[model samples]
Target: MTQDSRQSVYERITATIAAAIEAGAGDFRMPWHTDGTMSAHPVNITTGKPYRGINTIALWAAAQGAGYGSAIWGTYRQWAACGAQVRRGEKAALVVFWKIDEREEDAGDMDDGQSDPRRRVLARGYPVFNAAQVEGYTPPPLPALPASARIAHAERFFAALGVTVREGGTRACYIPARDEIRLPPFAAFRDPIAYYATLAHEATHWTGHPDRCARELKGRFGSESYAAEELVAELGAAYLCADLGLACEPRPDHAAYVASWLTVLRNDARAIFTAAAQAQRAADWMHARQPFAA
Candidate 1:
């Protein structure tokens, strides 16, 4: 297929998969295992093995499901290959090529019913490149923050989120055991305005603690829940940035979780609104906490 056509196909397939996930479609399982009429070629490390039948193919798909962060669905390269010859009434088996990372071997290479489970070796391999290379997909640059912002502005942002910032020698910002917020020395604060921006972001997260707003902050770093929190913080920062007429400095750390965010957003249309509200509340809480200059 032409590159453009292949890309179109990939987009369609990925969209379908994303929609299915959003609609509550659980992990993909081997159809043969569900039915009872398919098998795979025996693994021969010496000669390598070709994926055979729908069950084996589905198993590979299941393995792909375990990918995390931006690595999910690692580089799929599909090509139509010759089918196995069959008897007069038998259906032909199409060969589906899968070039995945060696790390996925354990999940992808499990035998249906003829091997010791302990024999599985989780060896890892790096792929130079298989497919995920699309042109013109550059991410927009992160926004920049200006210098010369007052410490009071930072305090105000914290107060709006219902947190108070304590002055300390250190230049870092953190919530104090879910009670009060503490910020590092303003002098120590790097890029004063951005430092507060970062503080606002973290303060928003602090609100989610059980002792605070009690937002569920329980998910693996790359899972949907974590991504949701990140989205909240980003929105919160954006809101505060707009209020202060500051540039919205993008959180570079968030790039790692972008795929998961995409997944969550695709799954729930309402999630964006909920996260945004919580973010705004957090921003407001911070703004309320700033000490007013007399």
Candidate 2:
């Protein structure tokens, strides 16, 4: 791929997500939010691994737009390798990967006779088709855990993070000064999913503390930095929920942030890419705390 390939990948993914956000703006829905059909995170059917970073968001947006019930996806050849064929005329979605370009260069001011090796990582786009667009293959069945078990699992997950979370508040937020998370009692939420989802959001914020991911969360209200942080937390929560096999729902209070997010994306084509990468880091940080984390 050429230099233009990198910009096109970012622009294409950004435009897809921006369009999904705009389509859902009226209902306060986000591209990341999962309806029950999309209960699972986007995964590569061949690799059986969840997509990460911008790929996850980009595929989710594609699934949401196309009403794909399955979260599994793969390259056209991958599907064929799995004994499935993409249906006629089915279009593919874009995902990106970084390719390293390594070269030996003159080492300036170095006594070593050997030239130093220089490496440049470039973003390259790959097209993948959803399982829903294929025939003769099936995604593995999702486990059906009881509600109590699911909540217990979430509790254990949060406890493992070791973040100081204080229950009993009218709103949920991460207090950067205190380096703690605050949320209303679990009973305050409409359901277990809502409670855990809210916790995930705040936990993402907690990951951004100066000692952690170091995102700028102390910016003035309505500032671009503040809004970007919110966007990161939102995407982080969605990613975490998907990984945990929970359906993420859009928070009603966060509707106001959508306009700001759109503004950010419109102002900078790479905004979504940066936000998704930051969100992935936040989610990975939380996952690393899990006892069974790979």
What is the overall TM-score of model 2 with all chains considered together?
Answer: 0.89
Indicate the worst ten consecutive residues by lDDT in candidate 2. Answer: 106-115
Best by TM-score: 2
What lDDT does model 2 reach?
A: 0.80
How many clashing residue pairs, candidate 1?
23
Please give each candidate's TM-score.
Answer: 0.39, 0.89
Query: Candidate 2: where is the Cα deviation over 4 Å?
Result: 35-39, 101-119, 217-223
The CA root-mean-square deviation of candidate 1, after full C-alpha superposition on the true structure, stands at 21.0
RMSD to true structure for each model, in Å: 21.0, 6.6
lDDT of 1 by residue, 182-283 (tens): 666667654666666666566666766666556663432234676778766655555555455444444444446556755774665334434544665555
Question: Relative to the true structure, how large is the alpha-carbon lDDT of every model?
Answer: 0.41, 0.80
Q: Which whole-number lDDT from 0 to 100 does residue 202 have in model 2? A: 93
Going through the candidates in order, what is the number of backbone clashes in each? 23, 0
Q: Write the per-residue lDDT of candidate 2 for residues 1-294, one digit (tens) a residue.
A: 677877787788889999999999998888899843334678888778778878888898999899988889999999999999999999999987765445322111111111134635556678999988999996777777666776677888989999898988698988878888889997898998888988999999888877776765333223588888899899889888876656689788999998999999988777787778778878878888799988
